[model samples]
Target chain A: MSEHGVRIQLDRVTKQYPRQPEPAVDNVSLDIPAGELVVFVGPSGCGKTTTMKMINRLIEPTSGEITIGGENVLALEPNELRTRIGYVIQQIGLFPHMTVRDNIAVVPRLLGWDKARITRRVDELLELVGLDPSAFRDRLPKQLSGGQQQRVGVARALAADPPVMLMDEPFGATDPITRDKLQNEFLRLQKELRKTIIFVTHDFDEAVKLGDRIAVLAEQSHVAQYDTPGRILAAPANDYVEGFVGSAAAIKQLGLMHVGMLTGLAELSATSGLPTVRSRENARDALDIMLRAGTSHVVVLDEQGDPRGVIGFEDIAGLLREEVSRVGQDA
Target chain B: MSVKTLDTAYQVTPSRWSRRNLTVPIGLIAAVAVLWLWVSSLNLDSIEARVLNAEAVRRAVVDHILLAVSATLLVVAIAVPLGIMLTRRWAKPLVPVVMALANIGQAVPALGLLVLLALWFGIGFKIALIALVVTAVLPVLRNTVVGIQQVDQSLVEAARGMGMRASRILRLVELPLAVPVMLAGLRTTIVIAVGVATVATFVNAGGLGDIIVAGIKLQRTPVLITGGVLTAVIALGLDWLGGLAERLLRPKGV
Candidate 1:
């Protein structure tokens, strides 16, 4: 199987537990490009985890083949193959007996790194995850809080710097604030690392926030839609996705895509210094730039950098005020 | 000459770091010293005479410790693997039954077990050894099973997914994490074995119990005190060692 860059192909994958009447995963086939963050989103027990596990052969596929980097994963020794791919989980299962350094150095040690190299790698990972290695190196898993431990978990997974990462709700167990911070931190990490990633989550909002392309698995592991976050939001493939995305599809779509791409040069001329509005004069991004900038009146510049639309605090405020007035009238 | 002088000075005056680390060791040695001194202050001639020509007392203490050590080592060798086996999926279903059996072994009177073993293996160290082995197995086995079984499931899954073979996972991850608790269990077993070895004198098993039993038969206080104090010390020693192992083996947080 000579393959293109990090292409993961799932060919007719199906799984049926012993004595079960139904297949947990139906005949599903998907092709994920290299260096993409693909989110597998679904309801509980819809086989998203089963599908993810099959990629690494953790759960043997009853019938199907998973190819990573153009090599059929089934051909590689499971342990040898798994060690080469990064894995993160919601439980953040840091080894209780191993210090943070040892935990992060696990794969490196298995691959026969000398003490100095393993130590250096561990220290590097701790810093990458935003923890100071000097303070945390000798500490045990039990001493850290949930969020800190999860950070270590992510750092440990990335220690060997594998080209691919499989994450199962890595941020799901964290509290909202910590989860948000971790999400942003992980995105930053991914931007730099560019590991081909398959991230699983039940949270659609999370899928929208993080995925380049989100694959919505409906009941019985049926693929409802596998498209860019924008396509899925702007034109849902089916009603299940619409109902599944529920009323928040628009809001979620806002996150899935870059505002700069959607807005034309014609649109940027209207919004004002939205102080938070960046120095960027992108036509599409000016809206967020205007909102976050919070300076009531804004100017959008044409290609010549001349003011085109003068958006006032009242126009933005009126949008909010209209909702308020509508609620007041309804009450 | 200055470097040589610094070396000499360092040897004579221990570093503060060394002193801090040695605190527990210092306290332990002090207690032992205090006990020895207190015993020495007792000027009772019978006891003093027995303690001075203490060949008999020495033999008894040595024999008791040897038997306890033997029992604990044999128990660990047998129990650790058995515990690992019992924690597997197929074997897991039999844990309650196996635990019931271990509990029954413990519930038997040590004297009764010794008699039964004597009938089976004949009188001597062998019967006593068999009895002690049976008595010591449960703690190590139970603790090993509990420790391995309690490893977080997700960690196991992560290891499995990473392609660490079952054997490697058991060796590198499962065993290391389980060690602190297992050591605690071993400590408990060793202390219990020392206490039990005393009762083996009934079967002509010459442990510290021999001196105590001899004192009872001869109506002598000196033999009894020597045997009793030594057994107490042995139990305390094993307990202290276990505590130290637990401290050393347990890691700080991530």
Candidate 2:
């Protein structure tokens, strides 16, 4: 199996329903590079979902060309094309009557994979999704918790190991705590799989956390700004995008930066009484520790929990200023 | 925590011979024994004896069971596929028309339908069987359609999204999910078929109805009582079997 993802190109894709005054998605074009997770962020009914669905032909484009791995999507049979692309939705629709193993085996079985291969693949997927194959395989969907069910839904989508994946609000239905956990697990999985993924969601924070690149969309599937999370948070493209970025843009940007990014840290001896944060922890976590402890500095610890250096409030502020200036230079 | 409790509630009790499962059959047997004892107590006249003989009663009971079983099987065969076809995207327009025709079949009185079929075709077991199917088909057909329709559309979409063709979705997702409702409809059809088969005797198709009719014409209380009690027992017995089948056939975790 090829672990590398292939590029997906949507060339002026448009979706027009019958008798509608305007198309749902109007001439939307995007170039999603192989092995990158791109988030389509917009308000509800803004056609972001419609655009993502068009990539898999769940909602066919009225007039446009979509090519995956340089192959024309429209020319291929829709079912065959879908089998080659992974898809996950908000509801986590695991068939209620099917066992978890059976649900995940659906695509493999459809491809006419042999019994031994499908059984092995199903177990492997359950393990990949952080489920215990021995415990969860025979259980039906109703027996699992909501988060577990959603994990199975993801595993089922990834069953045939499609190079490209489409996820629409995959974590939207869970509570904030579970959604956070699932997002982290998904991020870890994506890191290993490196699939070309187009994720659609309205949650800007989620887009920031998981997307390698974010495409902030407006009405009619118009791309307002498409850039890395750091760039978008530092300098929004227009007023609408700025409005989406909302307040505390600097703080949000800090969430994306690590403590290691702040150079020239004071000696650990000088900040012995300060709160502590791991070097891998983001700058935002460091900031949170400082704010809660009412201290101006925090000690950054390495993997062994030994304090290697100290970071202060001024250092974070200085880093943000430099980032903003860099973005301005790029503009 | 709540899900665990719900899961435990669905666990099957270890014993298959639970009291709840035995109640129907035991009560039905008791009713049969009481009827037997009462009928045996009567000192019957010759006409009553002729109709109440063991050989005649056995033949009639067998005919009654055969009529009900065969008619219900035919209804399932005819109605299930037709219902599946009607719910399909291309055949959606034909739904109301077919439902209307099914409604007409049920709307006609059972006796009237049997007599008309006998008038049009010659009177026999075949005419009686046709009447039983027409009278009992509506519930199963309606159930199958509604059952498939009520399945969550999102599940169907998910199946399609995973590359399942329409036929595969129907077999693996739609039909299995629809089983509970379809089985309920089948149970109703079975009861209706048993009740309608009694009227098969009106078209000269042999059944328990013969005893009842003979008792009525001969003016014999023992014969009438025997016919009435036996028919009621058969209806109850068949209904109990239908209930068991409903439980057994329903897809688990639904």
Candidate 3:
């Protein structure tokens, strides 16, 4: 295996459970680049989870190879390999008997981190996940709400600061409002961390919102199409890929752009009373703000919280028009 | 939400001297006091004639305590580990077999089991101890297996996925979650041991049962009451202690 900036590579991977006729995952290959979040989206029993679990060797592949950071994953001991990769699941299985601090400290402690470092890391993670260390550190999992527990689950997985993370519907259990809030927070966190992540979800919308590239999987874990969310939405490879893209592919394409990415900022002087959106917010959010304010333009704030530019209704409409025509040209 | 309301409800219940909290301890003390007065009111001459004097009662109680405690400790040492082992993959096939053996141990009457052991090992302290331990192992063993098995599989999976070794998972996850139910099993075993050890005196192991047997043979009512009261009090006291241990040892907010 040759090392590359690309973090994980799967070559012709296949998994066949005993007594089952067809393979759960068959002859699937993927390359996940470093510091990018790639989502594997598909319907029920599509082998999306089976493929993700193979990366951690939770479910070993019957054939083919996987390499992480240029080293063959199968060569490392399963437990040792797992320690180097973070994993979060939908159940948010925090150890019920452990305090939040202890739960977060699990991986670091297993890796033989000293007490002082583990303590610092645990508090850092609780804060990172938007949990107050003082209030939540000593509390058991049962004491926290479903959303809070999931946050702790994410923190616990991040404890050792592994370079790679595997998340399987980590936000699937919460109510829609909480789920949206968690997704937003998780996206913001991912921006700073930049770890290579393989996120598994059945929701194509979530893939568009979070994925740097989306791998639309079908039965047998076959990659129906693997491309950037914008490209997939603008030009799905075939009917199967288009079906998974959902009906509003043009609208989903707008979600891929931030307000900061839009060029030709109109004069901010004219938008003084208009609603404001953050530069880091999606173009869809900027459009929503403009619509709700009943204004032609909204002020876009940069990272420093200062107004950097203005995005008007025309910019959003222009972006959508470009997406529609691009798809038309590709067809 | 519901969790917030539950927290407030838990807080409203006072910690010290609450009726719910003090009921067991208070009841124990009152019962012991009444037992003492009744025993003291009995005719000393009749009790002495049946060999049920204070010194005899003291010796019998001591013997009974030793028998029950020793048997309980031995059972715990064997059964808990065996139960945990049974839950593991290697031992899974053996679980049904071992549980069936435990079922047979309990199915046999206590007196019959003791007599059977005596026939094999001869009527003595060793045979009596073996019988009591065998009879009492089932509850603790069954409870331990059930407790560990009932731990959420997701928690175990999460532990494994986090790179925790099997031993670490057992110590940090499985065992801790299993404590409450395991303690319930232990309490049952200890209480059973205390009651069953009285029959140990049949093989001349020397316990509260000696007085009861002597009283029955001699037709002495006072002696019988004294023996029964002493045995019952000890059982009650040990049971209360077990309850306290269970509460104190339980993980918070379980």
Candidate 4:
């Protein structure tokens, strides 16, 4: 099977529970391009999960249509459709009685893969999730730490290598440190897999960190604003989205930019004493270094730690201003 | 950490030869030996000798075991599937009604139930088997439902989300997780079966109950002691086997 994702389109989808006046998700429409991570950010009861579930028909829509890769979702068997879409949830529900190998092999076994191939795939997946195959293959879920179990959850979802993934706050239950670590590892993995993913979360900061596009949702699953993180932080479409962006919009915008984006940096000199920041580090980190050392400029280093050039406070500030005005003009 | 340390840290499987497992069998052997010695010491008259002889004692012991074991197997066959059926979404409404009937089966005394069955169906091993099954079915049936219900709902949803059919989920996920509790219930049923099998002689189904009934009617203490001691020993021995089956049959890491 090809590892790349296919486009998903939702056309005026609505979910109305009987006896409820307002539809849980009312006439929402969206288009998600292949190989992008779109986050659904909203309050607890805003029907964001309901909207995502309709893609795989976990919660069937009351009206309208959803298509993945241009085939109507409602036309296919739900079990068949779900097999081709990876799903992960906050609870990290690993089957307790099965060994890690057996747990990861569930989907492949369902697909009727041969025993040798299943074993090979289980080991490969365990390695992909950063668990040592020989050490962990025979262990049960309760034997692992919470972070480790969550990693296995992700690996299990990816077992069939589905083109689309739906994650509902997959890291929500972990401790803060573990959550941060899992997010970083997941981001690195996603860079390579490039599956079209709908990540549902209430945390706007998480949306800013991981989402390629943010769909800020309001009551009854209304899409308040749908844009990139930089745009949403720079120019929120309305006060509802502005409230979500909060007061730290400028700093959050800086976080979206890297030092390598800075232009016309002064050439580094051997005698110049300056703080050093990596080129891949975000602009916010460079600004923090300048603020701490009471210096306007810090030397930017490349991958080999060689001095590439110097960036000053004005350079970082200019990047943020340029982004804001650019989005402002678009609005 | 080294493999040695990891092994020690999660030493979940207790050793098969641990004290807890060894004690029951050893105590049972000692009890049997004492009972044998005590019986031999009694200078028996003809009636005591007739009741306590090897052929008669052996027949009674064999009959009792067959009665208890067959009844237990029958109870398992009837109860487990019914319990599983009751837990399904469409069958949920039947749960309370079935449980009430099972409760009534348990609430009636075993002797009374046996006599009633004997009156209706006439007396034999079959009547006694039905009586034992009716008396012991409640625990296993109740436990089967409870065991499946107690599995984490998220795990079921996870299985469903992964495209597992309902039957596949029941077989692979639900049933394996439910094994420990189901086996515990079976253990209780075994003990109940053994206790109730002694009452089988009341309906002309031969067992250790015959010897005890004869001793009481004939007013012979030696016969009573032999029958009573042998019945208790068999009960303990069967319970030990049940415990061992529970530990062995339970799915690993559950």
Candidate 5:
């Protein structure tokens, strides 16, 4: 499984619900890398959800192909394919009758895992999502708070350890504070598991916080732009992508293109004195200084306060310029 | 949440039964006493003898309660599946006709139904059982379908999103959520059957109706009152008990 890469690609996928005059998802294609957290974001009625649902055949494509782990999903039984892909939805639909532990064990039970292994997996997953099994196990869904239930929902989705996960607004139901906690917890989980993920949400902030690559879906399910978060913010493909990012394109670009990427470049190595800040300094500040310095990019200093890399003006200017013209049109 | 509802490991809340269990039966006995007093004050010559002798009419009451329960259990077992089947998206279109059949079953003169059964199958307990079962299906079937249909769509979506199989989601999430509605239907069906069962005794079935029928024959008020009191108690008791069971079995915390 490790050697076999999981890359999700949608080649001209189209979905038109019967009796509905317009297509929910237009012909669109996307390439998402293995072990990356990619997000598809758009307004409520957009086809972002339709695109995600096609991967495992929850909604069959009217035309085009979808492949997971290099295998065409249509070639496999839908139920069999779904079992290999994790799905999480907005309501955090925990089984009301099931205990927290049993709820988390849903997929593993479906897979027919032995009791001992399944129990261990449930406990491990409960702990990963920040719920103590000692306190939470055996408790029914109604006993849990909203945030806690969402954690269980995630634990359940990840139970089978599927190579890819589909999340549709998994945190949309929670309060801002809890949503942030869940988002961060998910980010940490993804870091450790590195499963290829396709997360759908309308929240731009959530998309920025969680996505490795961000695909902005417009009305009719068109892929306005699909690029790394930093690249998209720095360089939007069209006016739709620009408006979707909000008018603060420069600030948003700085939010993603950190000093780390600039420091990685070979040209940035010659400058030893780096822009020094606290360990907690914002990526925005590092970017702001790089822009003011008129270089392609700047270096990131360490705890000892040393120069890391020399950033060129292109690092800051290139993508921002591409997005700049479109930003006004959207505004 | 009851302490019993929770495991021994933790506490939830007091069960509603703790106090009511003590209060309800005691209250019923008081009502029985009030009825006895009211009747004794009447000085009705036949009342005492009719009740004390365990008149033949009182026999019908016991018979009816048993019929209602047995019929109810059978209907639940049968209708749940049928109801669930009817609720499937592809099968949903069939619901109207099935509902109409259930409605017709209920609309038939319950006595005529038994008479038909008696004429066809011979006069006895079996004929009455057939009539009662026919009447019971309307509530059970209607409730089952409604309960299944009422399951939260988002929960089903979430279950699917987690890659759960269709059958698994139906069994665990959909069924549990639909339980309250199903039980509501079950209760209504049982109550109706309990009332109907007494009338079944006219067809040679033994029940509270037997006491009522025998009381009228013997011109005995005691026999009639005793049978009526017990019949009422049984109806109310089963209704309360069914309600409690519904509350107890409902997916805890939901």
Candidate 6:
């Protein structure tokens, strides 16, 4: 009902398939704080998806205690519980026969919302996902492109305004350009909605870009490293976690630092005649601007267009060494 | 670009009147008119002295249409539910067996099947109806099962994940998607039944076949030609109507 998110807890969860030597998911536990996005990242068949599905009771856990907003989830009827939670999948499975409006209205209609309320909610959702309601409401799924259908998929999942959302690679099937656009739009929406989301993706870069916290899973879904993206990139627990992180460890760490987080900042008097990046942008964008302008520093703008400070090439370089030296000292 | 050229480019093509869309109905009317004129001009005094008069032909045509229509309605009522049941998990294993039975229904000749039913029910409209139903139900039932099963599995999974009950999912998602295919099957059945209903006249159930059978008995070629032409026209007319029904029932944007 509120824009705030709810807490979800998975305590000692385990899923073992019949006749398999190893369990699909070993004894695992995680505490997801309210209003934060936690991403589960690992390889295919590593059980990251299985862990996320268990939250919605889509795939019942073999043995575990799961709770949402302090209520025991296992005791509730699955269909009833599902209605209170939003779910989206990689396939963007819109019903081909139903119009876009009806597809987005499925949950509300199931909840027995009245005709006027459902119509209003559907149009609002279409707009929320960047589709013009009047133009798209009557069109069928087959009429839309893949990217448009994915937008409709997100709209449908959020129709009833559930507090918690479970997403399994929701934009995985789109082309690179569309996927990037969708990811940016989704991030903007999440900032406004602040829903408790447990997103599962095999792409670690996506995990780093979107997650407030990232959980890297090993074989049998064992948590290899559970920490902030900056910390995980700085210090992987073991070889298994490192392998999933791949190369460019320092570059990935740059994505976690915002322009506003920089200390020892120097002021820039002139706001124009130089490339400007926003205060909320990552170190990567600032670095790109400095490189393109062929200058030592680029103006970092505040909420308004005025320049607040400047970030130099050394400033970006200093962030990488800041953690490396700290890690060295600890060792 | 110049405004004069732009104005010229925007000029619309003059619309022409077309009877193309009305061709099917117009053709049907014309065929009926020609057949009626030919029948009236015939010197059928010899035939009229017997049972091959205009009154008899009218009765035969009406009886033919009624038998075919009733048989199609009954087939739709029975076969659709049977098809849906056979698609379920518990009933899936029974599909091969049911299809084999339906194949047998079509494999045996229509007259042969009618005679077998006639022995049990005694020769009349009931036997003719049963024969027509058995001969025509297979396509609709088979297509219904295949259509429902072929719907994308992810759509159903998405529906379930969104908390739709199984019954609601079937009614809202599965049935609507399967309709176009089901209508195709229905269209096939109606056309086949119209042709097969002609055999009912041999059992004294009264159809266009009565005129043809009487003509053969009396060696009257004019009566025979009249019956053959009427039967063909009715079959073609049923096919056209079936096409119209399919177009009307189809879900838009599919």
Total colliding residue pairs, candidate 2: 0
RMSD in Å for candidate 6, one decimal? 8.3
Error (Å) of candidate 4 at residue B139 is 1.3
Question: Of the pair 2 and 3, which is ahead by TM-score?
Answer: 2
Model 4, residue pairs in steric clash: none
lDDT of 5 by residue, B46-157 (tens): 5445544444434555578779898898888888899889877788568778877888998898988887888878877777777888988887787777776667788887
- Model 2 / residue A47 / CA error / Å: 1.7
User: What are the per-model DockQ values?
Assistant: 0.42, 0.68, 0.59, 0.59, 0.47, 0.49
Model 2 lDDT tens row, B1-254? 12221121112212233469778888889988998888788888888778888899999999999999999999999999998998899987787788778878878999998888888898989999999999888888887888788788889888888888999999999998887778777877888888778888888999988888888888888888888888878888887777677677778777
lDDT at residue B186 of model 2 (Cα atoms): 82
lDDT to native, each model: 0.75, 0.88, 0.85, 0.88, 0.77, 0.84
Q: lDDT value for candidate 2?
A: 0.88
Docking quality of model 5: it rates as acceptable
In angstroms, how far off is A270's CA in candidate 4?
8.7
Question: lDDT by residue for model 4 over B34-139, one digit each (tens)?
Answer: 9889889878899888888999999999999999999989999999999889768898778778887887887899999998899899999999999999999987
Of the two candidates 3 and 6, the one with more favorable DockQ, higher being better, is 3
Ranking by TM-score: 2, 4, 6, 3, 5, 1
What docking grade applies to model 2?
medium
Per-residue lDDT tens digits for candidate 3, residues B1-254, read: 12221111101111222357567667777876786687677656754554866678789989999999999899999999998898788886787788878878767788999887787778987888999988998888887888777788888989989999999899989998888778888888888898899899888898999988877877877777777877887887787777777777776756
iRMS per model in Å: 2.4, 0.7, 1.0, 1.0, 1.7, 1.2
Error of 2 at A195 (Å): 0.5
- lDDT per residue for candidate 6 within B190-245, as digits (tens), equals 87788899899867899988888887878887778778888878877886676666
Please give, for residues A104-164, the per-residue lDDT of candidate 1 as tens digits: 8888877888999888888888888899999999988888888889889988888777778
Poorest stretch of ten by lDDT in candidate 3 chain A: A1-10
Score candidate 4 by lDDT: 0.88
The order of the candidates by lDDT, greatest first, is 2, 4, 3, 6, 5, 1
Q: Write the per-residue lDDT of candidate 6 for residues A189-299, one digit (tens) a residue.
A: 999899999899999999998999999988888998888887788888889889988998988888778988888778666646778889989898888788888887888
Worst 10 residues of 3 chain B by lDDT: B5-14
lDDT of 3 by residue, A255-320 (tens): 888888888887767655879999988888887777788988889998999988887788898977
